[model samples]
Target chain A: MTPPSGPRKGRPRNADADGAILAATREALAELGWGGLTMGDVAVRAGVAKTTLYRRWPSKNELVVAAVAEQLDELEMADLGSLRADIEAVVAQFASLLSAPETQAALLALFAEATRDPLLRRRVREAIIEPQKRLVLAGRAAAQSRGELPLDTCEETASAAVDIIFDTVAGTVVHRMLVSGEPATPDWISSFATLLLAPLAGIGAGT
Target chain B: MTPPSGPRKGRPRNADADGAILAATREALAELGWGGLTMGDVAVRAGVAKTTLYRRWPSKNELVVAAVAEQLDELEMADLGSLRADIEAVVAQFASLLSAPETQAALLALFAEATRDPLLRRRVREAIIEPQKRLVLAGRAAAQSRGELPLDTCEETASAAVDIIFDTVAGTVVHRMLVSGEPATPDWISSFATLLLAPLAGIGAGT
Candidate 1:
């Protein structure tokens, strides 16, 4: 199904062109790295004109964020019978995403660049980091429904719990794969899930 | 401290020069970023000859690693009377180190570059990552001695537990400060330590 047309647009934006451009950006990142990638190269790869690329994404940072965000959106939490199973499944999915050459090459470089550019940092947070928190929320709700976790009463406390949980899950997987130079194997995932479950179920109970 | 000399070839290495070069590398990383940093510029900044810099570290990767490793070595875990206090103290220390402009600029970039270079990745694992795991070991031993944590019978299980704890602590802190673009304040640190304590104490007991 085609997305409904919106007001204040010149030509109806081409969804196919947008997909091609984002795909090209990821492909370029995998092959050329952040330093070597250029708008011209991406445009050529996407089979679009330079003007077209520029009209869509004003800078490399924005373009890369869009590409990475699209990929991150692929992360989803399913009710896998128990909190441990749900955690492990999502972790495995995340590990698989980070293990990709394109993601490995793009993510840290974007983050490194973001340290210097506040605008890019905000783009990264909004596009990539914020959306991924939904997994934590979804997981929490599923566990609560299953009686695996008590329902959180305070809104502020629940939000804080989500932040901590998101950081722990994402941070551990990233550090394990990117910094420690270790594979997030099934064994490692199982161990990590085990470590996380007790605390996860205990969140908002008091501490 | 200067009394002992190792058996090696050529003149004795200059400790002062090593310190200057590493310090200069960090300073340069803060100002110039990874892409802009060069060996010649670092040598000049350190008040050393290009040949001297080359003799010490063969590449930018090695120089950055040495600089980063030296800083990482400063991360020491004090007994601090209790497990939660120890964990929070070290988490604060790690967060402080990461909050520095030099470390912030260099670490993720080094990790990003290491993804494509196998030799650099090995150097990072050996120099930066492996040493930091000692903190986890120290914390665990202290906790066990205090009877806050149970002693593990299996060596392999103990090692696996260490890896999980290390990754969770370090990864959560890094993600919070760098990726999430949030401050790892005392409040956040206290909450994180609370969340970690129960699971950490239970690591090798069963799951």
Candidate 2:
């Protein structure tokens, strides 16, 4: 992707610099966390000048927001002819996202920042959370409109359900990785998708 | 209550000192937040020796935990006329725990500690979390046995519902408070509880 602004410096910007910066952000997040990452380090790792980095973004929070937003894939909400299918498919996508090494690292860093910095918290929520919640709420509404889902489902409830389903998958995957230092398998998504939708049908969908 | 095991300290250990300390903890948490509070400040306000304060709870973590636990009132699953009443009662009690000034403060501190301290995290999950979950499961079982809930409603699902309900409530509540400096209310629980059961009842329990 081209830079939004025209560049003029000692040398033309490296086309691969953005990717390098993103990768470094991911690695730095996993190893050192959000608090430990510095603008100078990011600039050095990306092979960009401190002045050039500052020119592009005013703050580290802005830079991180861009990285997290660009890296975490929005769910593919497929219309699968059933509410269960739609919810499960979206949840399955989230599980895959949680297990992805790059996104997982980025998100862990984001969560750490959220604990300490109010500005970072707002940025993360706006960049990553608000859009994902919109997707879940819209999907729930789509299912309800088709008569496949209970009509009483509200946006907040759907939003809450998304947290329940995805957080557990995220937590379990993190547990597996932290406790055993093992990678999550693709099979976990299917099991998670099935187990997550247990309350969506019959009479158990209140959550 | 007398000192658990100690020679009589200065000033006869003021019979009301413990209450004063706990009250001070609540006030400090509500006003200054977990990160902003200090033991020296609490000692001054409570009119107690720093040594006496340390004698009660060795560290800030231990003090906050004890303070939170003191505010918690265990709920009994009495046989209410309907399953809704029983469930609602338990939720109300649980909400009270989180909504209280001291408990919420302690919980936010614990959640922050969870990111770094593996021991604190484990203790939080086991001592604080597991017992609350067991209550929801046991309460659900009581409903099932009384023909208020379906026999097929898995205890795992019930427990998960409770977990997300409380967690989301906490997450959203904190988000609101942090951004707007408003207090989190209990109003969400009524609709939250109803919608939680709606998915279980399917279309039969119409909106």
| The best candidate in terms of lDDT | 1
TM-score of 1: 0.85
Off by over 4 Å in 1: A1-17, A38-55, A202-207, B1-17, B38-56, B202-207
After TM-score superposition, the amount by which residue B32's alpha carbon in candidate 1 deviates from its true location, in angstroms, is 4.2
Best by DockQ: 1
Q: Could you give the CAPRI-style class of model 2?
A: incorrect
Write one digit per residue (lDDT tens) for candidate 1, span B1-207.
122556477677777998998899988887777767888899999999989887767777788888888888888898898888898899999999999988887887788777767787898888889888999999999988988887989999999889888888989999888888789999999888877876666544322
TM-score of chain B of each: 0.89, 0.72
How do all models score by TM-score? 0.85, 0.61
Model 1 CAPRI rating: acceptable
lDDT of each: 0.83, 0.57
Which regions of candidate 2 are displaced past 4 Å?
A: A1-75, A78-81, A95-124, A141-207, B1-59, B73-79, B100-105, B150-188, B198-207
**Candidate 1 residue-wise lDDT, A1-207, digit = tens:** 123445465777776999999888888887766667889999999999988887877777788888888888898898888888889899999999999988887888788777767777888898889988999999999989988887999999999989988999999999988888689999999878766776665533312
Check candidate 1 and list the clashing pairs.
Answer: none
